[model samples]
Target: MNHTLTFNWMMGFVIAAMALGAGQAQAAYVIPMIGGAQLGPMDGTPMKHLDISFDGTNLSVHVDDMVPTPLLRPLESPDEFDPAEPWAVLTDKAYNYQYGWNPAGFITLPSNSAIWVQRLSQDSGLESYQRPPASPPYASIFASDGDIWQWSGSMTHNVYAVLNPTQSVYSASYRVYLGDSVTGVALDGYGSDDVTLLFNATVSAVPEPGTAMMLTLAGAAMLRRRRTA
Candidate 1:
């Protein structure tokens, strides 16, 4: 091989290696959540706010944060991705009573967004088991927009939001409000807060070497074995 050709090939190898490293570092984010009803003072009317918080300084869920699950058939469907859980909600016996968010009322999902939720698992305590939920280790909770999902802070429920894959990037905005399990009314009068999740699938990070590279390495090993023999 000529010197120029060898140098060019080596540079390409370095670039590919860098790409692999960047992809690993930028792997889609999985946001863990800890939420509970934060009650207001007794001097005024009843007000309850479900505070959804994470460790990030700017709590905005950026476009790069979605969990990336590539499509099973990547060759056939290169643009399409698979449904994945980019975020999960869990509790730590924070509160005792059973509380929930009403999708029909206070909770608002992005319009025309294909997003659903499933309860992966939970510890014993629903008050315990608010309603007879489907057996878990991944029980589909609410697929439709109006489906109501309730949980108790007394128990540990791991809830995952699954986003269906499409050609374009997926983004969702959630307006969460604390709801009364009985009358089904918004407890917090000030419904000014909301959390938005934006996911971009640009970093195609999962690595698999090319067929040519594999073949070249095998050839080099065979040559070395022949010389030793």
Candidate 2:
């Protein structure tokens, strides 16, 4: 009886250890279409809009035409674009969305220049852009959960185009990565020619929790047979 009880205790520990270990291991989560976007009117008010994306690890925001100042730089190069400093925030224009957490600070645009925010983790490591949280100072917002976002481009020329602010046209060429650890990617967009908005981007992950549970149960049955032998 004593030996049998000890064996049962060992089995319980083995199960608990395995579960905890698996949880600690890296897992991915993807958000299909995070939330809706709000672009300001073309003529009357200075428009503000947000484009969000996730690569299982990071979140990015693109604030376009939030201010009406002439674009200091060209729109063709979407990767190197940066927001104007001193943070000119346009309250009249904004895009709201929920990604499992209440965001603290929002990416601000002065309506003059184009700016995009991206989050990357050290785990993503070096030039390899993957879906990871942004390091300090680079992020205007700190997300609580696993989130990733990217910026495509802005609509600066079409002054009268705001009544129907189309998604930026350049969003189609952009690529999002998760980390050096995984691969296999897909991308989507929001706007038209010369301008494109990246509505959202996501990378697939391991089987969901329900599927994992089923696998665990199956493994447990096999373990029981070995223990009996």
Candidate 3:
């Protein structure tokens, strides 16, 4: 891409990224995510990705990853298994659409799956916007169980998706629509312009770091005693 186009491209990406971690707590068992976005196509298919658009007339949003990553807290249990509530996390996997599908115009993955999402750019060309989970800086929010988290342009952020042991599917569906002001009335006829992204993971009970280590040592000792005997 040319310098101007390149600058705009990166700017869009960074703008969207800014909304992600703005006011978000810095702790959640993270599962790293990877993917690339282009203003074009790849492998013949329009990469199903977070498609944010505005053609000088209207604003539209399309939403949709992943790689094996070391579990930050290998023991973070999802709501499906550990009802006691383990590490509430965000994950980046695939858009299985337990709901449905939103075809995209631009984007394609080179190899592995990824968590493609709306580039949270303020230049949405819309007057204003907002979504649920209320505003940012929420405490102890974000979970392995499906929930749509909004990315705001309040500030810049570096958010990472977390994984579950079982590898089930979950989503972060955010609503994107046009409004008169930041916290204004809706005007866009197209509602739910965005979808919280889905992620891949499974379930297993996880323990605190200390407890996990102790359990591991105990198990290893038991195994050794059995072999010695």
Each prediction's TM-score against the native?
A: 0.27, 0.17, 0.31
Tens-digit lDDT track of model 2 for 27-57? 3322111121222234233333434444333
Worst 10 residues of 3 by lDDT: 122-131
How do the residues 1-229 of candidate 3 rate in per-residue lDDT, one tens digit apiece? 3655644554555446456758555544332122211111232213234445444344466443322221212222221222232212222211111122332344232222222223333211111112222343212333323222333322212222333334444334444544443333444443335544444434546778854565555556556867999
Ranking by TM-score: 3, 1, 2
What local distance difference test score does each model get? 0.32, 0.30, 0.34
Candidate topping lDDT: 3
- For 1-229, candidate 1 gives per-residue lDDT tens digits of 4756654565566557656767653333322222222222232212122234222121111222222321111111111112353212222212211122222222232222212222322222221222223344344444433444443322223332222223233333444334555443444432323544322222233335653564455456556867999
Model 3, runs deviating above 4 Å? 1-49, 56-58, 63-167, 188-196, 205-229
Ordered from best to worst lDDT, the candidate numbers read 3, 1, 2
Candidate 3 positional error at 74, Å: 6.1
